[model samples]
Target: MKINKNIAISDSGFVFNPVNGESFSVNPIGAEIIDMMKTEKSYEEIHKTLISKYNADEATIEKDYFDFVGLLKQHNLIDNNEEA
Candidate 1:
């Protein structure tokens, strides 16, 4: 999935949707995922990178990644037309 171009994300994990005027805060890991998504990283690449950089296993990372993406989707933070 791709982050919507209009969404504003802060380095401190603050996310703002200008369209809806909705703001949210995420953890460090969630910030990293948002950064990677903004860079157009694929899910598999994100999963691999997280595994190599952190102590988490592949399965855990994969599950968390998808769950995060799902939340983004539910909140309309992602661009459904774009491939992530």
Candidate 2:
């Protein structure tokens, strides 16, 4: 999924969605995952990267990624074209 143009994301993982008038903070891992999603990375690609970087198992990464994606969907931060 792609990040909404109205959203602002900082290197420190501070997220601001102007359209929704919402602001949130994320940890480093969440920031990394969100940045990857914004780049339009596929699930497989993101999964692989996270697995290598975090030394996480497939199942764990998959579950976490799904949750993260779900959050993006919930906030309507992602565009329809990028919906999974």
Candidate 3:
């Protein structure tokens, strides 16, 4: 999924949505995922990169990834117009 065009995410994991005037902060890993999403990376690529980079096992990483993405969806941080 793509991050909204007007959304801004800082290197320190601060997020801002200009449209709604909402702001949030995520942890380092969450920030990394957002950065990747900004680049239009596919889900598979994200999963692979995260699985390889983090010390956690595949199952845990996969689960957390899904959960995190779900949170992003629930919070309207990602664009829903396009399928991922």
**lDDT score of model 2?**
0.81
Candidate 1: the clashing residue pairs are none
Off by over 4 Å in 2: 80-82
Clashing pairs in 2: none
lDDT of 3 by residue, 1-84 (tens): 788878799989999989889999999999999999889899999999998898999999989988898888777888766564
Point out where model 1 deviates above 4 Å: 81-84
Question: lDDT (CA) for every model shown?
Answer: 0.87, 0.81, 0.88
Q: What's the CA error at residue 60 for candidate 2, in Å?
A: 0.7
Residue lDDT tens for model 2, 12-60? 9998988868888888998898888778778789888998888768898
Candidate 1 has what TM-score?
Answer: 0.90
* Cα deviation of 2, candidate 2, in Å: 2.5
TM-score on alpha carbons, each prediction: 0.90, 0.84, 0.91
Q: Per-residue error at 68 for model 3, in Å?
A: 0.7
Q: How far does residue 51 in candidate 2 sit from its true spot (Å)? A: 0.8
